[model samples]
Target: MNHLKIRSQFKYVQHKIEAIDKESFRYNYNVIEGDALMNTLEKISYETKFVAGSDGGSICKSSSKYHAIGDIEIKEEDIKVGKEKALGLFKAVEGYLLANPDAYN
Candidate 1:
């Protein structure tokens, strides 16, 4: 597993891979600075699983879990925003994979 650190204008995030295989990937991330940290977000974890589809494609199932700092509660709207961002990233990856079929293999 590898650890990554990302820095941007709005946030500094740390990511640690929990597990990975041909069919699934799992990781946890922490917002260590900026907006999310100021807003009480502790960490976010994600698991993505891929399965073969009927028409020679793949079906992706992804889940995200958010943790708040201390006793603070995260808002539903905020979670929704996170979900949207994740979906966008997924689509971008899918597009790249589709464009270069042998890239991953």
Candidate 2:
């Protein structure tokens, strides 16, 4: 994604995550708060993967699994989730960015 698009996407996820964080704090459940924080981290981690063009053929524009980050293996289930999340986030972000390219500064 482009710079401005990244900013907008960041805001979109950040807002939702902040809401969850607020609830966690209000409940005062240390365990729940930790879990929520980890969930938020997971979201951001997946978001990074989605943004870094690592979701497979679409983002990388190549089918060759030549390079890799680790000994990671891409299973069918993993592929399904990757595609879904990547495509979903892309549509959400790019759609908005297309309509309002200058949304972020």
Candidate 3:
């Protein structure tokens, strides 16, 4: 089996995204702060790539024993839509990794 994870961290005005591989214990994909990180993420094909942010914040769940991204905004009023978008985006990435395990190998 293959394990792919996406972890997100958010502060007052900043957010972070980390891509990890559980099978190989490798966590190297990091989306840094600023528009550059946004640009980098744009290059990747993920379902959540097009989620626009609202005036409020989003929520993210904490990391689990198998898969988790850390604490983030998942609530839309508090950012519920954003949370859904991020999850969708990560899910797409997970699908890609599962379909092409050799790409990581």
Top candidate (TM-score): 1
lDDT at residue 15 of model 3 (Cα atoms): 33
Q: Is candidate 2 or candidate 3 better by lDDT?
A: 3
What lDDT score goes with residue 6 in model 2? Answer: 37
Inter-residue clash pairs, candidate 1? none
lDDT of 1 by residue, 14-96 (tens): 56676677534333334334564456776677777778789997788878777777999888997898788768767777777
> Per-residue lDDT of 1-105 in model 2, one digit per residue for the tens?
544333222222331222223332221111122222223232222212212344552242212121223554445675566456556766777678677767765
Where does model 3 exceed 4 Å of error?
1-78
In lDDT terms, how accurate is model 1? 0.67
TM-score of each: 0.71, 0.31, 0.33
Residue range with the least summed lDDT across 10 consecutive positions in model 1: 1-10
Clashing pairs in 2: none
Identify the leading candidate in terms of lDDT. Answer: 1
- Quick one: ranking by lDDT, best first? 1, 3, 2
Q: Per-residue lDDT for 69 in model 1?
A: 78
Cα deviation at 53, candidate 3, in Å, is: 32
